[model samples]
Target: MSSSPRRPAVVRRAPGKLFVAGEYAVVDSGNPAILVAVDRYVTVTVSGSHTPGVVISSDLATHPVRRRWHEGRLTADGAQGGGRPRGGPVHVLSAVETVAGLLAERGLPVPELELSVVSTLHEDGRKFGLGSSGAVTVASVAAVAAYCGLELSRADVYRLALLATARIDPKGSGGDLAASTWGGWLLYSAPDRGFVLDLARERGIEAALRAPWPGFAVRPLPSPAGLSLQVGWTGNPASTASLVSDLHRRTWRGTASHRRFVATTTDVVHAVTGALESGDGPGLLHQIRRARLELARLDDEVGLGVFTDELRALCDAAEGAGGAAKPSGAGGGDCGIALLDAAAPQDISYVRQRWAAAGVLPLPVRVALEGIQQ
Candidate 1:
């Protein structure tokens, strides 16, 4: 009997995420964060490879990469020979290596493949900080799993993508991964880092990939009723890693102050969640204002400028229009979100005009109801 013909190309897409509330504090165990999966997406297409190795090309990359698995390692420029290419996309390599390792550990045959990635998560070479890396990893993993005839749930994709991202950078809280996996509004608490790391090392990658993630939870929540969300870009990109590193170096973690901060922020998150459930627009505004104050306090304590003048201006503009606003993620720059009292066209247009006057670019984004699509 002849072998079955190669499967056709697999295409997958995952949406980017926005941190509605709870940023730095979510790193603590069991702390809750509110995030939304945005409309922008990263799409990955995977097909059978004719060459001896995998070929990866992306719109974001200047060149394509050909890699092969040999002697328990991935070599660049195919299986035959060539030095590893430098300065390619880190997340792409991380995702491919991670899936390859997991397949090897499961005693499964590795197939030669080709991948093409396209994304709308960036504008004019500037990252929107919309969790592009996390989305790309999710899409890539989903595509590869399908290519290998492995069925993975959203949760499985999340766990695998989390591990893959951790291999690239262990500091991520996995909130982005969660949003990209499940989509929509979510209240997420990260899994225990120490436990996950130990598990990955003790058991083989297959076991780790298949293992149930402990202490992590992601639940969907309804969007606030009648509340309009808007995003404004500051035209300046902020480094989330740099902001996180600064917070860490300030000795902000594991201190009494940190505990107080978490408590205050958690209360805000709970208040927001409750408001969304109850459709309390005023309550939502109050909680967002409180959260912004709490973040400001944290910034003052750490001497890090989490809130820039532009962001503050945006917030002020929203408040002036009878809305509430705050910096979305790690702050310092990037984007800020405004929650309007109404979803009327006039209301949105007014806010947009004010945001423009404040020198912030209003981004056209909406809450994505769907997560990863294959």
Candidate 2:
């Protein structure tokens, strides 16, 4: 326990992201993706604590866990307040540890704190595949770092969050982090994860941030002109990590087919980005349909199950309503997005009704104007 005086809570929230285009292909460094941050958020609160160690509570976890932060590491002390913590809060713990690493490097005190997270991204502890993990990690990093007296820019926060996330899942593209960091509609590409991690391991977080990340980039794009975005949940959650890892495990990973998939996906992403930038709604819609077909072809070739029955229904309904739709992420099953002409409210309404009839849930969320913020 600390004898230090108590401090007010520092609260930060990060909005969940939905991939408008580019899914499996985005995993490759520099492969671009379009994403938007939604109003749904995961909020993290960090405050001074009298506890002997760190106490973490989150809506997604069954029980809180206590951890000891020593020398930039967070070691599980024990379960707190109930049955044993199952894996505890991995993303939050990683964020805390990553921040501690930076603080230690700067010769600051690593104080014990109470960290709590509540998310609108999940229901009954089930994620809607709205980038809950990413939002939580982003929010936790900002909140914890702010509580520890560290001031960070959005880029700084994103760098730390990516470093933290890479520590847990190296294969991640960090597209979600980018969306959660910047908010609104943006075009994003990931750096080489392995390279970033290696740089951090050999040098430090600060060193890694200062170093040139070869393939990573983020460019904000205008929201589709005169087009409205719609989202539908398949109710079945997916393991993005699993779907992605499955791609790596397959013999298809480095094969010619994989190369073709990457090339085609990259092309579609660029074209969609162009349409978005030009405010060509029809062109954007055309590109989205192409993107969906591209994923469908990849699925057919590799058997990745990119399109679930519910997701297919979701997209079909959108198409039936004369809109464009596609699965959002790695897409074993999660969410799909639809784009309809804003002037045609009836079309949007029809799509939503069809989605509900197909057992897909329509999420009433707008694009968030800010990313991780107080």
Q: Please tell me which predicted candidate would have the highest lDDT against the true structure.
A: 2
Cα RMSD of all models vs. native, in order, equals 2.8, 2.9
**TM-score for predicted model 1 compared with the true structure:** 0.93
Across 64-182, the per-residue lDDT of candidate 1 in tens digits comes to 87666665555663354455543466677677777777777767776777899999988877888888989999999899888888788888888888888887666778898899999
Q: Candidate 2's residue-wise lDDT over 125-189, tens digit each?
A: 77899999899999999998898889899999999999999999999999899999999999999
**Which candidate has the highest TM-score of all?**
2
Clash totals, every prediction: 0, 0
Clashing pairs in 1: none
Instruction: Report lDDT (Cα) of residue 77, candidate 1.
Output: 39
Quote the lDDT for 244 in model 1: 80
What is candidate 2's CA lDDT for residue 249?
91
Q: Give the per-residue Cα lDDT of candidate 2 at 164.
A: 91
True-structure lDDT of candidate 2: 0.89
TM-score of 2: 0.96
